[model samples]
Target: MSQPKDVEADLVFWRRLESQRMEVDFTKMAPEKCMAAMIEPDDVRTVHIQDIRGKETQYNLKLNGFQYVWHDMPELDGVAEQSHVENVVVPKTEALRELSLIIWSRTGATRTVTFAHRVRCLSEDEAMLANNRAPAHSVHSDFTPAGALKNLESVVPDVAEREELLKRRILAINVWRPLKTVQRDPLAVCDWATLNWQEDRVTNRMVLPHGWHELGKYAFRESQGWYYLSEQQPQEALIFTQFDSESEQADEGGMTLPHTAFVVPGTETLPARESIEIKMFAFL
Candidate 1:
């Protein structure tokens, strides 16, 4: 009557520093807040993680805050599977958009919002920015409540449409995948329901070129449940929630997923992880 345990490894989380406000901008482009320090190796704990390969489809986006599936892109699979030196054909924006739409149906998103997006295929070997750096190790969610609202303002061009969409449920979710087979640095995501939102959620001011907005960081809690897929390939994806309109409501939908790229033990000799995540919104 016992279940099988999966991959377990040490992953890092933000330390709780109530004495002083801790803030950071990975790009270092934002104005400094007191204790504007970055997450270092010393600021982490080795909470051994067990792999969750069996929970691929079992994890529900409405309940667990994350779901894993084989979202294969056959159109671009050959481009990723092989090694190219002379010319690398990146998936076009339209392709990524079409991919997201396909994934939406697979994920069982009941939201009625019509997705309008411009996706990009970026690699560290080419353009490097705050977003395109080494896989970030800190556990965090991309946006705060206010930030999601700001994002709605920016994305929805028409005022009437924005207001109409605001009346319904809104969500900002990230669809992440490895362009190629991941050798190391697989991502670990926390179940949103298990988080102690009131007591442990750490809010940070993230400055960006557009403007500064609140970002959700976390202080560790044993009750928080984390899971990840092993050796993720080009055919799979890790879809999770970033922001929710009814964040304070219950039984509405998944809220936030605290995710980080954790190093897989004994995989350092393998190739570095190369991945892409596209952010999209939903209106219900």
Candidate 2:
């Protein structure tokens, strides 16, 4: 067997938060990830991020807080290039909402509902550069508990109905997929079940266009396990959670997952990764 074997490419963590008191300029849009200009960038480490692409049963959303699944969307290739919010994004998001309901075993129950609130369209092309977002190169969660609750206020208008949904369970989910084949800068998600929340995560303030939002950054520990899918196609979607309301009360499974984008080794010649991430919530 003399086939050309691929060389090993390792990933280093670039998520050390800029630690120090600094004034933020509110004029600019949100910085991708929590990477605002800062005083110190400390303790960047080289870590092995396992590629579990071949293992189908290793991780699932219910336990690992993240899962990779097969989905069918053939028509969205050209639609992604046009980048139409209502035309392209709305329909894809509705599909994701349906997927969320079907996989979690809470479909068509009394008051069970899922809806998307925000969507981020990322690409390397010049035409889609309005938001100026590159893949977030740091490990972080999209929402903190306070930020999720604040986001809920904007999504759910009726106060009484919001209160009723709050009584059961609330979940914040990120549905991410590549508009094309992923050539470079694949995403890596950490196993939250292995992490000690109070000891392993740090809350950092991110300045958004609207206001500041709280995001969780990681403190790298030997106990933590990180993984990334290999060669994800357009029809594949990675579903994960950023906030789980019952996280603290649980013994295992159902918690927030933190993730980041990293350069795949020897992929410099390939096209840059273009993907869309839809952030949504489920009330059950």
Candidate 3:
């Protein structure tokens, strides 16, 4: 059920009372300031983790608190190629929609899943170029309560429809898969059951690329329990919640999941990591 813990991974943690800010010049497609010092050596910690293979072990989104799914889509095999993605937006969207449906069925929730327009693909080589669109290395969830509300508004547009949608149980789920075989720099996620959201998560500002207002970001907590799946292949997908509308669910550890890309010690010679992540909204 677990792998060896001899290997350590470096993750970005938040310092107490540390104020961090970032500004991006979309015109230049770059960050206006060096966002490095926002993370300090003191803020970085090494934790031992082993990858859990979903095929061999069982993980439930509501029960085990996370889901490592075997989602194989041949249409997405060439997703790493920018040209291929750009040319096949329609097929990509359809494929993602099907993926969301599969997640909903597996969760056993009587809900409708709406695919979000925001989909991202990242590569370690491109991230080293400081292009702003990089695999997030910090330990945090994708959205806070306020951020999730704002996102819903943006997607719905109509006031009455948005309000109606808000009355139901809403969840933001991310479907993630590696573009190639992941040899190093794999993603690590914190078990929701172990997270103390109130004391562990701090609100930070995130200035996204393009002309968008600053959004809320969460900082890391040391008490969190982190896990990863070793040698995650292209055929598998990891699905987790970014936001859950139900407040009481937090007590049961089925709310938001915090995750980040971490360097797996001693795999430096392996190929750099490339992955695609798509966000979907599920209403129950």
Candidate 4:
């Protein structure tokens, strides 16, 4: 199959040497100081596969930077039925665990998968809040190395066991898919091979309702390469890594990928983007 033609889209990239505060408060709806700015009309490329049957595309995760797999769950249909924490949110968490295990098998990683209970959904209407999920428009990774370790401790709970697990490798991955066929504000991820950790990454401090934390964001660079799957359906999922414990892998294309949402220019009257992202860690 021919690859999807590259199209121009607006991507938010951080400015270097600019002293800016990136603080977002979801509860108060007031962002004190945010540094994210848009760089419009940038090209986003795509790789098209005629058929996913018995090909390297079906199993390879590290080479592609991200893998698109077919995963259909009828339980996810109830996601928009109610906004309550117990009614709609809890069931989705159960689904995430099942999804995480499938990813664990695909990666050939012999480790247990621990999924975070929280799930994130992004939409066009900023005012629309459902179960503490919101759309993140900036180009960023969800966790920093320090932040990932902290999160690991919280989830594992046992100090001794957590310490033992830390000695081994750990991978932080996000499983993302659209609630419906995605036509607007789809996600675009930078290829891992194109990233230069020292030159292209920046740390951002996030202020949430519960507490403040730090994460990494990407600054625009001419050499950076971006890709997105066109018109993704609900049954397909995009799995990409945000953090990996192997230090040597950093030089050889680390799994932590940078990504963001963008407006596909020239599209008129598109449906609002609705999607779910679940985070999980694989202990190896």
| Per-residue accuracy of model 2 over 1-284 as CA lDDT, tens digit each | 12222323344332444551233444564443223342133345566777776673567776788877777876555654445745666566657656655675544223323444333344342322124456766676786676677677777878997888788678887888887778788888888787876565655555557766566666677788888777777777888887778765343223567888776667766766778777777665
Q: Model 1, which residues run further than 4 Å from truth?
A: 1-8, 19-36, 40-42, 78-129, 247-254
Give lDDT tens digits, candidate 4, residues 155-178: 788999888888787878777888
Against the reference, the lDDT scores of all candidates come to: 0.62, 0.64, 0.61, 0.62
Instruction: State in Å the error of residue 199, model 4.
Output: 0.8
User: Model 2: what TM-score?
Assistant: 0.77
How far off is residue 79 in model 2, in Å?
Answer: 2.7
> Which candidate wins on TM-score?
2
Best by lDDT: 2
Model 3: per-residue lDDT, tens digit, 56-152? 2455566445677665667666665666655663345445545644654544335444544223344442443224355677776776666667677
Stretches of model 3 off by over 4 angstroms after superposition: 1-6, 18-31, 34-42, 54-57, 81-133, 207-222, 251-254
Q: Model 1, range 1-284, lDDT digits (tens) per residue?
A: 12534556666666776632344564555433322354441256666565676657677666777777665565544543333211232334224434444544543334433222212332123323243446766787777676667766767879998887877777777777776777678788888888777666666765555676666677778777777777777677776778777755433233567898886778766777777665777655
CA error at residue 33 for candidate 3, angstroms: 3.6
Compute the lDDT of residue 81 as modeled in candidate 2: 47
lDDT of 3 at 275: 73
What TM-score do all the candidates reach, one by one?
0.74, 0.77, 0.75, 0.73
Pairs of residues clashing in candidate 3? 51-228, 51-229, 51-230
Compare candidates 1 and 2 on lDDT and give the better one.
2
Compute the lDDT for candidate 4: 0.62
